[model samples]
Target chain A: MRGPLSKRLFLWTLVWAVVLTLSAPTFVIIGASLTAGEMLQFPPEGLSFKWYRQLWQLDDFKHALTRTFYVSLICTLLSLPVGTLAAIAMVRYRFRFQGTLQVYLLLPFTIPLVVSGLSMMLFFGDIRVLGQLWPVGVGLCAINIPFMIWSVSASVNALDPELENAAANCGAPPVQAFLTVTVPAVMPGIITGALLMFILAFNEFLVSLFLTDSRTVTLPVQIYNSIRSVITPDLAAVSVVFILIAVVTIGLLDRLVGLEIFLRSK
Target chain B: MNRTLNRKPIAWTLLDAVEISASTVWPFRGRAAVARAFLLPAVLVVGLLLVGLGYIIEYSFHELDITTYRLKDEYSIINYHTVLERPVYLRVLGRTVLASLIVTFLTITLALPYAYVLVRTASAAMRKFLLFALFLPFFIGQVVRAYGWLIILGREGLINAAVTSLGLPTLDLIYTYPAVLFGLIQYMLPFAVLLLIPAIAAIGEDMELASEGLGAHWVATFRYVVLPLAKPGLVGASVVVFTLTMTDFAMPEILGGGTNDFIASAIYDSFFQISNPGLGAALSVILIAVGSLLVMGFFLAAGPGTLGFRSRV
Candidate 1:
């Protein structure tokens, strides 16, 4: 049942304030990007796509865009299978020190991002692969794989052990049974994990900042460099691009796995 | 068997071999060894970072030689001394801790009702809208959102323009301590809400209804029934928000205008600008220590799963 009118009013005001605070920045960026005037401003002097067109002209942004996709895709690809396997093991078996191992897996996520970035920088520098792109992708993969594992584990945990045992009793081999029965059951979790990992790698800033050189700069780092150098409508234009990606990702996630389940997995 | 052999001869032979191997290995089929085999890749990946953390701990003990870009032969606690003794470092640490406390409190306070509505509201459209508002900023990431604030609060930005048009003075809002905290709270609100959703969802509507039916005022019900039930969520959200804000690099770096640096910013300057890996490593080590201690303290108080790890049933 709904609350009394006064109580409902209070909640409505609080939620609206929160919703506005959460969403206002994207609106401001979108508004600023459409400015005909040169400087970045909200309540645009004249609505135009000049900044968006300007983004198209900039080679640095284009290169950073592709680099970001490349890194995020690589991270997702590497993390999905490994994370799914780990989740299967964690859910489908009972083993020694499993609890300790679970916490060990979460350590990469719990450690301060800056600390992980610094440690990675030092290690990469020592090994002399600091300037390359793949290490950055691998680093992203390592920290974010836990997300994939958790997502898939939720699905794995829901499956009944009896199903697999039944398949075995029917004379289907374990691998065949797993491929036929278990894979379809856990596909939702695998997709959610892959999408979440990709988005994370896309939005990752601190670690990429510490790890990336000019040759390996991702979109976020490139935007950071631009912010430090200048304030212009082009940044607002690119920010709109970021907002669009977020919207699309959210839409896809909601359609695929239902947003409530996605929230629960967190 | 004859029909299967006739259909695909080479494929059958391979399947037969695989089945034979599986049966032989099936003695204790769902065994620890099989689990280990599945876990090996993830373990190695986690190991890679653990080893890096080990290096960070080692690097914290040495001093950087400026001219040659080398660590000193003898290890010392001199870097830690620098972090402890320097007023600048101490100020940054103080500010970081204070800001994290404030941000955590504010984010959780705001997230609770928002999460409640998101979960409890009867309208499907409203739930979808709330989730959209939440995830949009979430997906936009911290860096871009911080930049959005620059447009809203910068000297010639939106708020200033509105004030000027209204014939009032535009206050200097950006590049201050408050601005950094404002951005941090915005960034952290989504995370807290996401974490708190399941916690709040676990508190079934029936419980609230039961409390209300017993003639408790809404406030009393919230105080006794809701808060008591959702204590773990509040604690978990608080811990996550505090640790994340404590090590936050983007908000202060973007909104602080270089004057208001957090510990993460200081670490960055030491490594990239000052060319002092030893100092950066030391700062990171301290950050790690404080974060772990706080999380450990929460675990002791709240038990395991405060960070939302669901143990097996």
Candidate 2:
């Protein structure tokens, strides 16, 4: 079933090279972040945590970091109920244009992030019905709601209808049966989905760029503007911090439900 | 399976009456009716955002009135004409397409063998390591990874340090097209593997054995058997990787320095730098059209190969 010995050996070498290449950036970033030199250098001249210390001293980074967490967390929480209900309707209902609706919600995926960001800017500018932060919140959901729907819908689809019907037959109301039966069954999916969207919103840059004015700057947008103004190891250190946070959370998520779950779109 | 519904509390009975009527009303007596309450919020939000998209599309045909920060009250294809007439835009478009094609090809090619190794390896530890290695980037944001490349490929970056250590000429890898392509391929490799793994996994071991038994060389087996079977994943990964690369903003911006630019960079400049939303809209419309065209090609090439839209059966 395997390839010939030589073929396998050739592939093994290729894979080794690829693994190194894929992982090299993270190591290099970590290494650069530890640089003691004045200029950003790799294979750092001397190891130091000065850059990491410098990040704490910077007001821009502190404020941006707080805003990033606040937005990502709030958006994830806000998106949960709406996304869960939508996923339920999508999975349970047999309706005209259901397929169209699914694609429409996922349209953000196909549309360039920057384009959507521009659209949101024009929109929010026109309609001040909601404050700036609220639109940014909804905009995050604009891109992320589909992910929640997909993740939760997978769990919803996996549930046995018999359980809900049984609860209903036992005189439990429909909402009560759903709360008792369906929600718990899908809790893991919901948890992972929230984590997934949190990471995405936290890391998102281009849309955040358009959404964030002077008043509401996000971490990634701040990092972006700062990088343009000057290149420094302190920025690298900040990036390392962000990556570690994401990696640690994702590590836990992978433990709870394998990354393979994402690979399987269904 | 009979249950005593009559014994339930009046509170529960009252709630059930409303729920039952909602699902069973004359105009709502279908499977879809049961879900009407749940779907209303998402519909409202999506409908609202679509209005934004409508605004952008409306603006693309007009000129920007920068003084007012509003589009001119006119409709024409002049913005598209401007994009076509501008040599820099044309050059960037060509480069973006070519770079995307090359990156997609290389990412998928490299990922195939690595994916096979990861999937087929008998040792659990190796698989775990491979999985860890693959998922590492998912944790790291694209901007961070691009910045990482800035460190690895900068004038005083890792490669330069190594070259100078050897008393050789230091290479300027950053601030160039190759550097952008290199970084993009690294970023996209994991995605390709993720898509390809499921496809390669779908090809049973027995089929490979059967091909080998038929006096076919392993290469021939791969060419005729594995490749064909994995086409769905290949096509899917290709469409995804190419579109992502084409629309990408970070790699080209971070690695391309101030001079080298992609379509996204052009779009960014038109809107943010020049205060020209009309042009920005035109460029975005073009990007979407081109991206959709390419995706259509992939779908035509590999029917049902695309994932995420519908149930398989």
Candidate 3:
């Protein structure tokens, strides 16, 4: 409805405002991490890598970082195959209770993280499965599966079933057809789902809090405990690192497959 | 298409015949069993999760011995009574509901226009960029995002720094109700936008053009044509956002700074710090009940068919 120049300017202005607001915290954390002073001071007296150096010295942070990656990686690996199978079943099979099953699968996504964590704590803690890293990873996997299913299902739905039919018609077994035709066609969805699942598991906190033992504290849990006890530039340093990892991961995913399709599936 | 029998490859032909026979036979006998197998994991996980919730519901009605840190199986409504009797718990519940409602409203209000622009503008590049910007925070953990706001809203944080630099007196917005509200709004904004986009896109441009051509102003057209079509999305987004904010623990814990306590923090304290599982379970049951009632209200208002997309499938 407006001139192209004005429209372009409006779009740019809108975008810049959002980008600035969203990235403001990232900048502040980065700046605070580089402060020469002991406190979290932005626009510091001088830039220094002291906090980054000290971050390594803090064994809790170091351990938490390693544990976080381990748990996230394990969870992602477990959820990917399970989620892919579920997605295939949902897309390929026409059953009487298909819609109901789809809804049931999505229950974890609708429930709050705190509630889920609390429930897992109660269930696992009662069963003495608490304080185990695998159970924690499993709980996170449970949450991630639905999201993985949804994203992959979106891709699966987009795929032409006739390809699988054709493969089967051309003397391929059902399993062979799935491997040769279905998996390749849905690889984008699988990759997108895996990336999102990894990120979710990587950044998960509430579930980790309830399920993790001292031996398996994730980074977000570590940062949270640190923040509660003290206000230090080290927290900012860790936050800066977290933001960078998130940005890089998200940017890579956006480049690999369009972000919009993945997000809309959410 | 390869129905012709190849007698030369006898072994292979027999194997193929066996495979085809098994496949055909399995559909009637084992299809149900296979379907159940495919569904077993989801059912087990969800069933276990619900069982946990059921345990909470059961525990909420039980009596607790503070001295032993044990729950007495004898049924009692004492915990609910305790919650209702204390004005503090009731007040916190009220504040939690109010905060979530306000956050949901603010989220939809801000997101709707921005989403409208995204869909209506038809700028592929801008849409991609804005969509990416919107989803960027999903990458960041909620704890970190809340902590980011803690930095922004603190006394010496960015907001205060900017205000003081302008020679204006600093406002004590942090560690108060508004701080909690602000954090909730920020958290729920992306969800609201995501829900609205598809709904808006589904309406397409013809409706808007037709409304405008009929002498309707942009505002009128939006209220009349666009809003009605987007009601399902609006309802679904509101329910999700409201329930999320209502049960949120970390945001209020970090930003509320002891000035406010939502049901989630209250539940956390009872369950963890106080080691009162019965009381904690009671509080959780109450929270879930309230959340479910709101969801039910949405479903009733929107009617049954519209609740389909609310499943997030």
lDDT of 3 by residue, B1-313 (tens): 4656534477556656766886886664534565665567656766667767777778788888867779886999999999888898999999999998799988888777667676766567877777767767767877888788877778877778888988999878788988888878777877777767766766767887888788986667778998998886787678778888898887888888877989888888988888877888888888877887777777777843222422234
Question: Least accurate stretch of 10 residues (summed lDDT) in model 3 chain B?
Answer: B304-313
- Write one digit per residue (lDDT tens) for candidate 1, span A159-243: 7879988988999787777777888888888988988898989999989988898888999998898899789988988988888
Model 1 Cα lDDT, one tens digit per residue, B1-313: 6786567678556767887787787666546877898898999887878989999889889998878998897999999998998999888888999999999999998999998888889998888889988988988999999999999999989999999989999889999999999999999998899778867777878899999999988888888987777776787788879988999999998999897999999998988898888899999888888878877887888865335334325
**DockQ score of each predicted structure, in the order shown:** 0.61, 0.47, 0.35
Which pairs clash in the backbone of model 3? none
Please give, for residues B1-313, the per-residue lDDT of candidate 2 as tens digits: 3466547888667767866775565345445666866877777666656777887888899987768977789788889999999998889989999999999999999999988777778876788788888877866778888888877888877789889999999898889989999999999998799778767877787888899899988888889988998887788789879988999898899899866788999998998888888998999899889888887777776763634533243
Worst lDDT 10-window in candidate 2 chain A:
A257-266
Instruction: In angstroms, give how far residue A56 of model 1 lies from its true place.
Output: 1.3
- Which candidate, 2 or 3, has the higher TM-score? 2
Tens digits of per-residue lDDT, candidate 3, A143-228, equal 66877886677788778878888887999875456667889998888888888888889898878888886777889988888778
Off by over 4 Å in 1: A263-266, B1-29, B66-69, B306-308
Which candidate tops DockQ? 1
The CA lDDT at B58 in model 3 is 81
